[model samples]
Target: MEKVMMILAAFVLTSTSRPPEHKYVYVDELKNWTEAQRFCRQTYTDLATLESQQDVEALSDMATSVRKTSELAWIGLYDDVNSWRWSTSDSDFYQHEEMDFNNWQAGKPNNVWLGLFRDSWKWVEGKNFSFRFWNEGNNEPGNNGKEECAAAHFGRSGQWEDWPCDQHKAFVCYSELCGNASLPGRKYFFVGELKTWTEAQSHCREHYGNLAVMENMEDVGTLNNMAASLGFTSTAWIGLYDDVNSWRWSVSEYDLDQHQENKFTNWQPSEPNNDAGRESCIEMFANGSWNDITCSKLQGSICSEVRDSDVKFTFINVDMNWTQAQSYCRNHYTDLARVRNMTDIQKIQTLIPAGQNVWIGFHRPFWMWVDGSRFSFSYWRSSEPSGSGEHCASADLGNSGQWENWDCDGQRPFICYNVVCGNSTLPTREYIIVDELKTWTEAQRYCRENHKDLATITNMEDVRMLNDLATGRTSQAWIGLHEDVNSWRWSMSDQYQNQFRNWAAGQPNNKFGRESCGALSADGSWYDVSCSQTLHTVCFNVCGTNPTFYYSSTKRSWTEAQSFCREHYRDLAGVRHLSDNKVIQGLVQRAAWMGLYRDSWKWADGGNSSFRNWNRDEPNHNGKEGCAAANFGNAGKWEDWSCGEKKAFVCYAAVQSKHLVKLQLEFPSSLTEDDSAMMEELLIKLKQKLKDDGVKGDVKVSWRKRPDGKILHKPKKKKDEL
Candidate 1:
């Protein structure tokens, strides 16, 4: 192994060079954030993604000649709040590193609702009432893998179980006490008469009062006793019906104040009898007393006028219904009179004829009882009423007891009650779960009718108690934890894992809890802003050897700019490095958008860079600002802004460099220029050697051809030898 080896040296010549890292372009077209992004991507690489002061300066210089001074241009920096966060937002509840705790199963949180079990349950009506009566024998909720609805079984002493929502079962409906115990003496009567809801209403009005308006739990108890006495264990019609058209005032502005003055009514001793179940409009007598009347009834209207902030009334002797009167008043005067206070009534009373009733501005409520009682008490099952076309209400007397909206034309047994001019009282009842398989909504109705409501868990102790209650029944049960789809998330799906942040002082404050976007400042800080603000935008292009940036002097909103960048370039510039911040900062003449936005906070590109540069107390999260912009006037810091704001933008593109490399080498005497294959082999070896020497990127090596259309020519003999 220690043998001496003869060595031969070969003469060679070589030259090499490299291209610049990136190139920038400045466009002077005036477009929105999105429009500018499109132009840049189509004409150049993409919106500029700055990475250093030099890069910013180059862009600035290029733009200075064509763009106005102090003008904001789009940049490739934005805000993204779409990141992973806990469902629990209470900061104090989590200790150090606890907020990051995770016990997810392998390949869990896969962004889809699969066969996983939910941590909690909820009532159909979304109430977190602390009560549990689950049938634990069969693992009740189990969601049964697909069962989302809950039901109570009377056979199980009111214990609950889960089932599919579409399952048909008898249900229960209940009404609250009217609270007005002085409204004459009312008694419930079971009409065993099978009629459509409409026909039933007509029959009830003609015979008793209106189909028994159960206004309270006492009323419910009364009806239950009556049904039990008659052994009528079946579904039946009730007076409560869906009045799809919501009540409103002729003046839209007054509608906003309706809630505050909802209790203000000047009914003339039960004047709103709702005769024939068709009275849905309001009328005022000369004495200022109000009455419910059919909307189709023709009558004179009282119009109001606003003069010097004081309302005045004008009576029009036109015979028109509520709708026509409203239009007429709006065209001729301000609008139908709105009785805000006693003063308004007095003013309108003076204009009314001695015994005439004039139309007023009030309309009927969405839900109404045939007896003209206030529709205050409700016991709707979870996601019930369908809200599609079902207008009539029905009570399930045999199954998971609950209230539901039904078709008015559907025939069913009915319950009717009469007023007997005497006071009456009812007794209390105990909770009893119905024994029937029905939807969660249906179960809720049954519970509300027979008991109080579905169980609502508030704490772990409640959970334990519920578990104990369901010990021998179903294992899973419904509680009251509705899933909210609205949460912090990133716009770019792939960049969700990024945790980098750069906030300005007091930024991301989520002021008013509306801010959800991110922004960049001139000083290289970050901020939380709105997504609708218009600003300059930045884009990036990585199609070349290296990332390059460009500046579009057009203004656009954050989203529009994003669409433009993604459509043409790689995406909005994602500055995951301090170097990138510096580069972007230098180019900023004004605040611009970047790829640092968030539904929670993420970059436009799916980069894992975690670099950040924030000003003190940044990301205040003020307003509904959900987009990110870079403020150049403040030293290229970041601030959240409305994405709809139009401003200039920046984009970037990638480029490749070519170098004319030359090399000379001495070979053995036996090797000749005609050995083209050997020369190619040598070039390949040279390329490999360069790679081994730490050279990156694409490298090519080839022999240079001479004027004689040949390469690797033999060297000429020395002058002395000649």
Candidate 2:
């Protein structure tokens, strides 16, 4: 019969708690945006989503606490320009013909469709036409030659006539009016983990709502406040990106409105003819007239500053490309100047030197949020979102949380958020040794029937624990560790694979193909040997931190040593690095047994831990040298040899414990007993409060439901013969 041992367990549940409206978690890991998103989904909620000022504040506070004042982290935001929508969706917003109205920028909306060249002359403003008054006597629009453009001949009763497109003639321009609006709520977190934009999006979608989306100035202000609290600044991913469509002002406010009079243009005759396809920026001639030009051209620029109802224009003599000029103006002034009317244009004209062109505030539109939120709110730093290919957005904490566009592949830390569910706790284990002599299989059976199972050592902490338990006990024992020759890995599984190694030269020569166990030499090198060899062993009790080594004079087979180590210590010793090998080498005077053996490298409890400390170029499987061992003579490097060789061995184990705390309850009348979700929220708050109060360890909080399925009840009113 198997003997089962019972350990102490305790816990407590209470009422009366309040959790934050939004919970944000800052992960410190570094990964691409997609990986970060996946981690967030698995570990917490999702990438931090900021819908309101409160959310931003929450994230800011968290960031300050972590002391990650200066760094960029991925958020749940991205760009999806392909999903375009009209600025206004109201059916009544446009009349029949108005719906087809278009005012493409110069040289845009490429003309690729088949159409009659001579008869297809269209309005420059993209307007439809039905009436025509041609210079009939002059055979106007005759397409007599290469006349691709039309001109109104004042000399002929104002009738239209075809003319060469390149001819320099006076032209007409127009303007229209536009307006802006706003929306609202959510929470945020400041993750310190780094990831790419796409990765961050995945993480946020899986774990939380989505990347932070700011829909109004209120949100921007809140985000700014959050960054201000940090006393330092850095950049982080946000939920805005460019889609490369539409056209708008750099300030984001003065967009094309509904009224025609509000729209204004002063393009010189046939001026905005889009010389090439590259003209995406606007430039003003010295005469205060406007024309479309390539954004890459260097030129002076005008900046406008708004004070109350008055606007002031300042000219910057520095020559730079459109984007650069925009940035400079933003950093030093309000923004590229906006000419609202002829008066404003005249004001700007006075600021310009003769015959000098300057950049203005107009630009092609392409920015949008990752979550499909309304693109109403914006808080961009001066000249941000300037680069053509930078379609991802990040918040510069150093700049009061202002936003900037960046490449999607650039790595950065991220923030994640989740709903408060309850408390959190971590699981642990303990180890013990049993004096016995048995084969590897028999030892495993014994441990399973007795203690939890054969000891499974993971980190140096486990080694330390085994060292503590080995004091005064038999120096030799069996442990629960083995290896699989086919797939090289440890039985306990984790995210990290064995990356560090120190191997002996030309090692692991399986003499007779029977070697399946590992041993250590006095000089700290490794070798495989037959499992039947008998060896002494070292054992440990607790798990955590640094590890110590011990040696015994007794000898046992590889299998016997493994069993002895398991009984006396945690398991066979697992040297993780040069330091660990050095420590073990100092203890052994000759050869000894270790935990590493060959099979499929698995823990006795069937853990999938991928931590392996091997010697360089070892386990070469030389002549079927399947077993592994440490050779102290070779700087504690590893080698492959037969398992049948006799040597001493080491063992290790982990220490485990649990605690429970009980508490009384109180609740506001508004909260009912059936509000389980609210109860969960309160529990989460309590957990956070504990953390705030310096409670450490893998502590978890939860409501221990009673047998009657109730965790809270109103206390019976006390009656005293009233």
Candidate 3:
């Protein structure tokens, strides 16, 4: 395919006047010529065989084209089929050069015979400074011993010669330029020395009205022509940036057409990632089109500016870890724009930019909203909260980016929307609307075809202020919740509908496909639609949760008398945060570890409480420090630290389905009738299983015990013997 492509490219130059529009296909840089050719054919095309002067001119912009005015490229010309002819020898277009391109470097055409191989001449010049070539098996040039050999050329100036297939050198990447003309209306082009996007943009604007923008191969060809005129080599930049998943034009306003389709496109694998969440810029040259690039890089760039409108605002990664929201805003937007008021949000609805997501200044408490409003509301998903002391809110401009309250000091990537707001509202139910470029369905699709679920209303206050707040949206948003399939369950149960749903009248009918999605009501209920229907929606996922009795337990050594938690009731559950501790403590009747110590009586659960809410100071250690247990009926069943007591100790493990996953499923029964309810069953099983599984136990040597409970053949038994 590579050979065929190059030939076709040659034919195109012979037939047209346009310069070559080639996009270099990168290969393993370590590849030799033969392997490189296979890779190109498999990736870009065959080794480049220049067939036209225009092709020659266009190739001038590429550094790897490797035509040194004399060095001959290995085209699809071989006599392997017993016929020595150029692969594409039809059309009588072969160059009748004034000098042979197959240069013979100092007797390089000599064929030497050695060993058992048949006698023949080799292309060995016999010196390191001089090039040599041969057929190893028969020590001959040309194809012999059923082996393949190739002819080399030094163009018209150097001597003609032959070479062994094993020699290594750089090869050319060519495409069938005769295919469909390149896509058109691209918004940026590369020029001169590589420059960072900002520098390039500035330079481009000063020169050819912003770097050339190309959306198609024809446009690429035109740029190629432009580059040929200016003399550039190697890869350069285009206007694409990684907004998120793929590359999109940086100055999207200048975009006139979309990208074109080409079979010879190249990709450097797993690229175009904008995952640090902030990088939304794009670049060219990893095989072809545009792939996302890191914004911090100083790569070559192409800029675009149409005659009708001027694009301002440059994107830059700041130099400090101490970037303030206000500083970021001042640097990007004008004068720390008053906390993104409703009007601003509405205006931003329309200009969703090409690719980027960021938090606006509306989040307060973290930062003072100049509007002098009390920090009273929230729009959090389940477990919505405030006062971890974070008062700032980041709004997602792309709808795909969600709105969230973040720590004031947290570092995050941000986007600056061109549409100004905090001013007025648009007169449409749809403040801003964008299509869902990627196909999706109701349950699967985000509220906005381009964004996530929907808009949210924190409290009745926000809802009342919403029509005014959502300067762009008069209608309510579709929350993430609704009846999925047949059940009337929200997609995320955590995001329960706040009191401010604006469902259309008589909505959310649970009839079959009717209640598949969530559409806010003008009054109360939500309207459900077919899960496949694509519609706009909004959500507010806001609610406040106070610190409460969220409880969980951990492992502690125990015995048979108590079930896990109740053993250290006073010590473990001792109302540390007095309020929360007491809150759940009332419900726990059985005594459990109050996370306390009895010997030192130190609280085991770990806290700074010096006072133990003990039951009348009853933690009297009876010499042997056993575990503690309390009678719930006893007043303040607390404060007990007996580590060795035997009780039906409750051991906790995560429950899967209804059963806990255990290392050893089967337990062994012990013969010690006095051992109280087979207490060692689990331990014995673990030891035996570990042995069987080749897991060694502490290898301390021990003696066998006699039936009479005495050590066998031992002089004296140690007091601490097990």
Candidate 4:
């Protein structure tokens, strides 16, 4: 089916307006990222740039007409050293920008190579160096190649310096033309200068409209046309990039701030430096300004909604984490109230009691849920979760369900909760102890085989139950809490459901620089390795009776294996427990990536659910890339998977029912027509006879569709063949 673009008319209903009339179009073609970008720009907007949840929803809605939920496409979102942007200032795409204005922290943008921030610098040829604000004491661009990019540091009066291109820093891109266009009117030029991603970003900012922002396939086609015109083929830089999930309104209406002036944010001078790497969620001060905090921090949640033409605000008095609070608000009312403008903010302010901090729907792009649950809460311990790499969270049952942020390998008593049981009829809370301590993944496996899963404590009662279970234990035990270091979510869950993680020791290292995928290692541990590696695959099948896992002898890449398993059985294996891992372990000996890959945390279905369960060490690798998998060795804790690696995977399917019903009848001997054809006629007459006796509703007489696509057919057979 061909994708059609629709201009949804705006209407007034609630307290705030929609963002803008973003024209969304979908391209039904297979092309790499660059080719897709070119096509979108020439035809419509750039490769369907998605800046807001509304934008994502709009594009998803448009694509649903031509694509399945599991199908993938090229959106204008690629991880080019973490700089995410759109082709123009379109309201929809701007949802990814944390703050529109520039307010850099002091000594910021000192582009550090590999993990070292230095006063370094280097000038790429043909790139504009016109803008300069050197500091007084050490303003020179450092000689180290690591500090190769520049940033506007608030510390040095907003001066600039060169920094590493891969440090996951914030950047500003300028498009000479910021207007949203339907067709290709402006010409995009290909600058051949060898520049870093940031330098190219700078060059584009200085030159033609910031590195050719493509809006749709037409725009992409224009670029492709440009490439064809110039015969240039190597990868040229574009404006779409990002290292972090930026902040957007919790209430994701398109016209919430159409004028863009509503984006005026009040922040403490030098606020949102992301103090630690984990500070991605937003917090509003009493004065209505916003600051970034870790999602695990405990705080009150502020929610707002439009009811009966009047915007109402509700301040939940509970102290819960961001995800938990999100679940609470969604379970009771609308999603965490999205504050679109000052009017909404003021409404929220009047409701919030003095000195009470709360979480709104506002959040950065990453740190989403695996089951696509609401990411509306955070409960991090103060001054905790201080790490530059990918970070995950764990709940501290010993501390009133308060959570602590730690590295991926931090060993602690993890928890898990189960909603579905294999045998039990009703929901039950059965917390079990494993005297034999193991990694988070191992512990998860142990709990699943014996019990439902690792324990999940949703409220104080559940936490108290855990406390009672751990009363006499000397040290902390593992629970079913997990978060993504990459902030990526599973494809099946779409970022709005609960997740349980179990990683191995020193695992998810993202070793050798290209480890964006995850693999289940021997002994049930998980590690982040390159996605291109080939290994055995695992498949899962959900037949009658119970879910069964299978190991395949054929080896293929993650994509191929996923395709094979999906075609033959089900999609790649999604191991939910320790029993799952042990079952898979029995099948294979070496390592392989599962169907679980990472997509930074996001909620699906707008605000579908808000439940999460993870082991302590999670969301590793700077919360960037990698899929998720359960490691049975660590109690089925989750880990990341690289999509390209060929690993044994698992697939599942629903039981197929046979239409032919067998009957043990008595008077058949008197009928005398025992041949198969005669039997068929007799069965038809028998069905009609039964219907005559009032055997209606699901007792209709119909022939089963044959394997050759025919409803009425019978195979001829010899006596021996029959």
Which scores better on lDDT, 1 or 4? Answer: 1
Candidate 4 residue-wise lDDT at 383: 67
TM for candidate 3 is 0.18
Q: Give the distance in Å from residue 657's predicted Cα in candidate 4 to where it truly belongs.
A: 38
lDDT ranking, best first: 2, 1, 4, 3
**In candidate 1, what are the lDDT values of residues 640-678, reduced to their tens digit?**
544444433211112244567666678898998788788
lDDT, candidate 3, at 311: 25
Per-candidate TM-scores read 0.24, 0.25, 0.18, 0.25
State the weakest 10-residue window (summed lDDT) of model 1. Answer: 1-10
> Could you give the candidate ranking by TM-score, starting with the highest?
2, 4, 1, 3
- Cα miss at 302, model 3 (Å)? 38
Better of 1 and 2 by lDDT: 2
* C-alpha lDDT of candidate 1 relative to the true structure: 0.55
Worst 10 residues of 4 by lDDT: 1-10
Pick by lDDT: 2 or 4, better one: 2
lDDT of 3 by residue, 460-546 (tens): 121223223333332222221111222233322223312333334655443432223343222222355443343222211111223
3 versus 4: better TM-score goes to? 4
Clash count, one per candidate: 186, 139, 112, 166
Decide which is better by TM-score, 2 or 3: 2
